[model samples]
Target: MHDMAQAGLTKYVAEFVAAATPQDLPDDVIALGKKSILDGIGLALSGSVAQSGDLVRRHLDELGLMPGAATVIGAGRKVAPRFAAFANGVGIHADDYDDTQLAVASDRVYGLLTHPTAPALPAALAVGELVGASGREVMLAYHLGVEVECKIAEAIAPRHYQTGFHATATCGTFAAASAAASLLRFDAKTTARALSIAGSQSAGLRENFGTMTKPFHAGRASESGVAAAQFAAHGWTATDKILEAPRGFFQAAGGGYDENAIRGRLGAPWTFADPGISIKPHPSGSLTHPGMTEMARLIRENDIKSADVKRVRVGTNSNMPNALIHHNPHDELQAKFSMEFCMAILLLDGKAGLGEFTDATTQRADVKAMIDKVDFVIDEKAEKAGYHKMTTIIDVTLNDGRVIHGEADFGKGSPANPMSYEEVADKFRDNAAHARLGRSAADEVVALVRDLERQPSLERLMSLVAKAG
Candidate 1:
């Protein structure tokens, strides 16, 4: 640990990844980590049924890419570990429903830090299965990957996201590499080089939001992690000071970064316990959740109908307009990022689940009319709440000219208002059923994950969840 005191950011991170062991996992971490992993699997299974996810699966089938021993979730087959990671990553994020890293700083916007589980968990599962790792080892690898990814995200300047980069894909490349290297027991030097290799591989654009390409960023990042670790294991060369170097990742990608966010902060507080993470209650963008929550609340408490609500106004800071770009969505993919669509659906159905995001739902006359009645604006009041909070103010005006005010700073599954474990289980069952997994299989998957750290291996767990009957 003392060695990290004098090491550069990259070297410190590499050493942290190299030395992680499941034996020292705290009780709290074990509990949250298992739930996070379980949640990732559920989202992946549910997302696999999506058109984007099916396309990725079909592409891999077409290539018949190198046959290896790695399970592709919902695909009922094994492929190369890298390819499997890619497929699973796409599946996990296909609906934009994966768990998100919480924002730590005021300038850091919610939902932009990264989707902590998407890239990291898929890499851990693919690599762990390839190497026949124990269940604890795989879970530990996943936690380590998330830790490094979050720290890097914190260290980077907020402008990185504001300037059109998708942090989940860019930061996630490093996360996947960290997980793969940790699972493989790469030495410190190899770990450092793997991270360095990942820096070059890091890529994702904000411009790709509202399309299948956005999820593809998560897939590519996961696959790139596998490729980088494999490359580093074979003595691939790269600068050891990838993070702190003048022209290295921090400066090249983000212009500048904060060293304090990295130094001695790798696992000292553990990312999950401090800034914490949010499990999404909705499949849409995190930015849209608060508004949806407020709208749903106003409707439910007031017993108002969609037709009775003559006008609605949703206001947030300027950052939201850039992230939620789909003003009018034509399909489920775009609906995930459309504030207008999200609120309209919640107003109409009281909830927006996987079943409500179809293209048909988006084009319904009532839905379209509701969408037209809502306005998204940048408000000074929301800006006053600061960027760290996803502060959303909702103003609903009824046809009778009665005005109702509602606001939500934290969405349903936020740390301030967490979901119970049973709720998470219900979510898992719903998603698993959507993917066509039998109820018995879904129950077993939950049981397996509940005691994941004690399981002998990933064999039974992955078998139940990854492959169809």
Candidate 2:
């Protein structure tokens, strides 16, 4: 074990985690915690029956792991905390419909933060349930986990992502470990040790983005976190200075480090409160959201038909195109990352939703024809404006010589254009229905999450999440 003086970045985070209490959280932060948790659970419910979720569930069954206290979301089963975390984590991100952290997008040079809740919430819920933690305890741990993960993402961002690392799986491991440690009520030393172990286990690559492996990254991160914390609780040793050492995580995984970004403010004003969370309005990449919303709006308001448009041009930041890597997607998974596919669907159907991205829909001749006419270009001005505030410009040229243009500075569901609680609940209901979970159980989950802090335990909430089918 390293001395506290030599503990470096790990010590700072561990100390904060050890010292923080539910009383330290502001009302709004607590509220945001509940909101983020609800969104993650909703996504997990929808993803439970997805291809990736089914794959992992089958793998776990093959392993024949012993049952534990934690429930696997929408699977109607119990498993060990680590397995449960892995399954639920995969489920949350399986559809690529979870929340995104755009707080660091303004740096232009740095990549965006990972989806903050995907790994953290699963770790919190699994551990919280295993330990019989209260709703407030789970919320507190969840908030701390996001805080640690996002701060690290800010510290070593664009480099971390540009280097082919998946931030959700890499940074997310630490987030999950931090929350699990909190749920386990670890001391500062143990928490720091767990984080150190987490750094060693962190692994995920962006090259797998368009496949089932993408969601698997989240699952492994969640699993690693529980394992790290559990191992630390049993007195496993690790380098407490793992985050700041010359050969540590940032040095090896990130292009470079911004010490100040990690060390600064330490929660003077919460990241969630400032940049906040962007609940998705669409199921595609967050960067493509502004353009998708605007395109749909333009088509609907102008009464444009598929045959009316000659071509569509979309302009966004340079980095925006990187996430939308699938230029000619042939599958549903690939279509989520294909700006052309998303744009084609919007122009042809006047909307893009969960049902719009599918193998059958993507292969349709009309969709293919529309995809051929959609063009994506990096706007120099928009790229110069930076990614912190994502912007999009759309210009549609009609065969009739009519041109229509629209611009969006922020996407719907952003903090600037927030979704109401009712809207979020509706999304949850729809996702639950898609998974064949009964409406009554879905409604109960929504109600329980809204009043999460008041719940005596997470038992009722977890029970409601079990798949009806």
Best by lDDT: 1
Residue-by-residue lDDT tens digits, candidate 2, 331-436: 8878888888888898788767677777899899999898899998898877877766568888999999899999887777777777777778887887788788
In candidate 1, position 281 carries an lDDT of 80
Estimate the TM-score of every prediction.
Answer: 0.92, 0.93
**On residues 129-244, what C-alpha lDDT tens digit does candidate 1 reach at each position?**
98999888998999998999999999898888889889989999999999999988999999999999999999999998778888899989999988999999999899998887
* Local accuracy by lDDT, each model: 0.86, 0.85
* Over 4 Å off, model 1: 1-7, 399-402
List clash counts for every candidate, in order: 0, 4
Looking at candidate 2, the ten consecutive residues that score lowest on lDDT are 103-112
User: What lDDT is obtained when candidate 2 is compared to the true structure?
Assistant: 0.85
Q: Report how far off residue 106 is in candidate 2 (Å).
A: 5.0
